[model samples]
Target: MFEYTIIDKSLENKIILITGAGAGIGKEAAITYAKLGATVILLGKTVSKLEAVYDEIIALGLAEPAIIPLDLKGATKQNYIDMSATIASQFGRLDGALLNASILGELTPFTQIHEQIFNDVMKVNVNAQYLLAQALIPTLQLAPNASLIFTSSGVGNQGRAYWGAYSISKFATEGMMQVIADEYENSTLRTNAINPGATNTGMRTSAYPAEDKDKLATATDIMPLYVYLMSDDSIAVNGKTIKAQ
Candidate 1:
């Protein structure tokens, strides 16, 4: 669908929730979605960064954005429930969500990984996604149609050496996407996983400190995949893992 999918004003008046909206791909997605006419809800751990994105959106004269400062590692089920409730009360419906927030943790051998790091990665990547998705299901159902995207990774498809808990968490994410897609197969919700490969982001720099940044794509470069998934073009594309390189 990436090759021939046409971009249009399909997201006008839609409500989208994006985690990790503070920087990198999440920030770009928030701005792009807002420019395309979606009312973006920016959720991230950094209050200052989310506010910056919010200010940018407002300055662009795009649809106004909402902000939620949430630390996924410490997020409880009640946090998701409260978020869902707030979105319901404020927007009346949720049209899309991008589960893009994650941590790199310790990129060490499994035996060399600390227990806390592993737990933190799992909590942010896997558990938080489950809780958020579960809480937002009803809100999504209220929409005429909705898109839900889970961020995946190359290590998720085939575990890499020294990737440790981060890779495991992404694999679990792919599983979660598949399970949710299957459950909503006959419904109006579409769920899928996207691997945003080799992006020039802080996380990528941390993962590959020696690599030449110029050789990699920026967050804006892979945004077509994000937009296509959230737009009506990929409404029937579900339960699949896609690459955005």
Candidate 2:
């Protein structure tokens, strides 16, 4: 499992938001961040799952978490704008945000790809992210220092056979991160992407069923990088593609 030898309360009092916070990498990141002293706003399609994570954080005596049940596949610009406004009202400012929610549509040959699947994947993986970022920029700017982390994939940087729309969306994600990073180059906000290579998550299991799950790193393992990117420790690092393994 991935481990972080260093632990600090540097994130104390930080207001952080994590999409896809109900499961896998997103869940682990939310738990870790809360433990390290950030008040996490958990966003996921499943209210039950989000509540579960919230309860776990409360159980640990960490910062209390808020739950937002939202499905990115069907979210609109107005939805993101409303969410941003809500966060601003509740937290005053957003210290960081993790764009971790994504959909992996059917993996098939380019000629065999279905339009519905492609559009669905793009809506969740690309469009929603863009809208969320656009909506949250004002909230992020209110903070003294803020970070935005986008979840990316290896296939994004290098095209692979049969990776389908998921890969394409990740590429757009990386590009989006770079564009935002560049735009906020002299500002308090920073953006970056992380490729959590071959972790033992449901998504990895679906992508590589033949692989030995026991050999893969757990979602917790890659959290150090996640925490680092979100916290002040990595304020100087931006617009870079980092691998968490």
Candidate 3:
């Protein structure tokens, strides 16, 4: 894990948005942020899952989280723009955003990759991130210090066989993070990517069904890096991809 102390209420008064808040790492991150006194916006495709997380937060006496149901595969640039506008109007500013939602398309041979699956993967993992980041930049800038975190994988920077479109999309994600980080290097907004290594997520099970999930780290186990990246401690850290073990 990244070396950073988890401080109590380190994120007090912060407004943070997390995609894929329905489950896995995204879900854990949302709950963790709320525990640290952030007003979390749980954005996911499933309303029920969002509500469940919201209820959990409320039960824990954490800040009341907001929910936004959005399907990135079908959403357009305008949708993101409208969403960002609403966030700005409601909260006045955004302190952080963790872009964690992604789809793991079928893992197949490079030559045997399906056109539709590849397109769908790219649409959710790359294009939607591009549009969403563009829309959220202004709101993120409103804070004294802000962090934009993109979720990445082990194969993102280094390619692996049979990873197909998923690998390609993650490379694009890393590239996108770097470009945004460079553009905002002098500003208060800092962009970085986290490669959650072999966490036991649903996507992980789908990708490697026979793997020993019991040996893998749970989402909660890798949150030190997640919390550090979103905290003010990492304001000077930008344009880099850090691993969460």
The most accurate candidate by TM-score is 3
lDDT score, candidate 1, position 107:
84
- lDDT of each candidate versus the true structure: 0.92, 0.91, 0.96
TM-score of each: 0.97, 0.97, 0.99
Q: Which ten residues in a row have the lowest lDDT in candidate 2?
A: 1-10
- lDDT of candidate 2 over 192-238, digit per residue (tens): 99999989988888878799999898998788889888878789998
Task: Flag regions of model 3 displaced more than 4 Å.
Answer: none
Better of 2 and 3 by TM-score: 3
Q: What's the true lDDT of residue 211 in model 2?
A: 96
Evaluated against the true structure, the overall lDDT of model 3 is 0.96
Error of 2 at 239 (Å): 0.7
- As for lDDT, the candidate ahead, 1 or 2, is 1
